[model samples]
Target: MPSPARAAAFAAAARTILAVTLAVLLAMAGGALAADAPAGKAGPEKAANASAAGSGDDEDEDDDEDEDEDEDDEDDYEGMPPGDGRDEVFAYCSACHSMKLVTQQGLTRADWAEVLVYMVEEHEMAEIEPEDEKLVLDYLARFYGRDRRARKMGR
Candidate 1:
């Protein structure tokens, strides 16, 4: 058998190897999560202003022009059905991207829930209140659901 001191040294070395292995695994998991994280914070206005402020006045003017175009695009949702959560979806969802994107999707209620979770986790959307979440899900599942699209398209 090995000497007592040699056995103790071997045990210590095994522990050291195990610790280093765990540290590397944890670091790799952290890197993966960071990679999946959104590009930046939630607010488009803040991001826009920060970039504009970093550049000169000419770029600021260009940003204003871009805002004007965004306003024009916002009109695309004018025909959205008026109801309990219409305003909530319009305000929250459109803050990041166009409402056209919202209109284009025909997801189930479960899928919409998953989308909300994705928005919060991956895209940094604010956590919505439970009541408002229900309203939004109801509206989306009623009006923008796969069944409705299927009926409309005769699929």
Candidate 2:
């Protein structure tokens, strides 16, 4: 029912509307892509923090591994005989503290037990079985007993 000029005008209006819609859609898409695009440059502080975090994680892993190795050394006597459970005590003791604690103390079995108890009670040392403690004490008493005569002579 439209006249010729009116039909042409309506067609041109519809075409103009479509062009505007297309332009808006393109602008939105361009904005979205720009938002997602990588930042071409990072600030120095951000870059330094990221680098330090990564390096810290690696160092923590290495430190944890070393602690694990120390614990293992304190527990295992892979080559020692069962009768020689003193080795286990030595292993456990030498893991965190030093063997000097044992060697330097001119201690009897009772003295060693007291020291072990002190370590467990005060310093939060590992819990050792009573029998294991006895065995280690006996071994130390037998092997590294004090030279009484030398002490008496004082020479």
Candidate 3:
């Protein structure tokens, strides 16, 4: 059993704690709602929604036009062999020969080694990536290596 004075003090403490808690909770909820609303360049929730709904469609249409322009620049590379940076290496190296011609020749690493050296010496093949000669030789060797002698196509 509490004395009258003690009971009144306890009741006052509980009310103060509850009031502070309610104030903190309301402040948090107000902050959450404001953040969830779009912060437009206009600065108010209703104006942000109106600006987006009314004016943003044109921006999206412009994006579609830009994507179409990029597609206009890409050309298809035909039948390159499997290798890392094969396309870049091919793009630079195979202007003299079709990718098909390079892939068709059956050669050991030593065979392509001589070809690369010959191109570098007789016809300038430009300085390739130091590692690329080996990679290209390996690709050429594996696919075309099985048949060393050439055969003409179509009887």
lDDT of each: 0.73, 0.59, 0.58
The lDDT leader among the candidates is: 1
The candidate maximizing TM-score is 1
Give lDDT tens digits, candidate 3, residues 46-149: 43354358554454467777566334312223444344444444544555655566766667668877877888788887766677666566666655564543
lDDT of 2 by residue, 1-155 (tens): 99999999999999999999999999999999786432212222343354467554454366777667545433333222233444545555665555555555566667667877898898888787776777777766654455532464584
Candidate 1: count of backbone clashes, pairs at least 3 residues apart or interchain:
0
lDDT of 1 by residue, 1-155 (tens): 99999999999999999999999999999999786433223333443454467566554366777767456433434445545566567656866886668887899999999999999999999888898799889888887899978987899
Q: Which model is ahead, 2 or 3, in terms of lDDT?
A: 2
Model 2's C-alpha root-mean-square deviation from the true structure amounts to: 24.7
Better of 1 and 3 by TM-score: 1
Rank ordering of all candidates by lDDT, starting from the highest: 1, 2, 3
Taking all chains together, the TM-score of candidate 1 against the true structure is 0.50
Q: What TM-score does each of the candidates earn?
A: 0.50, 0.40, 0.40
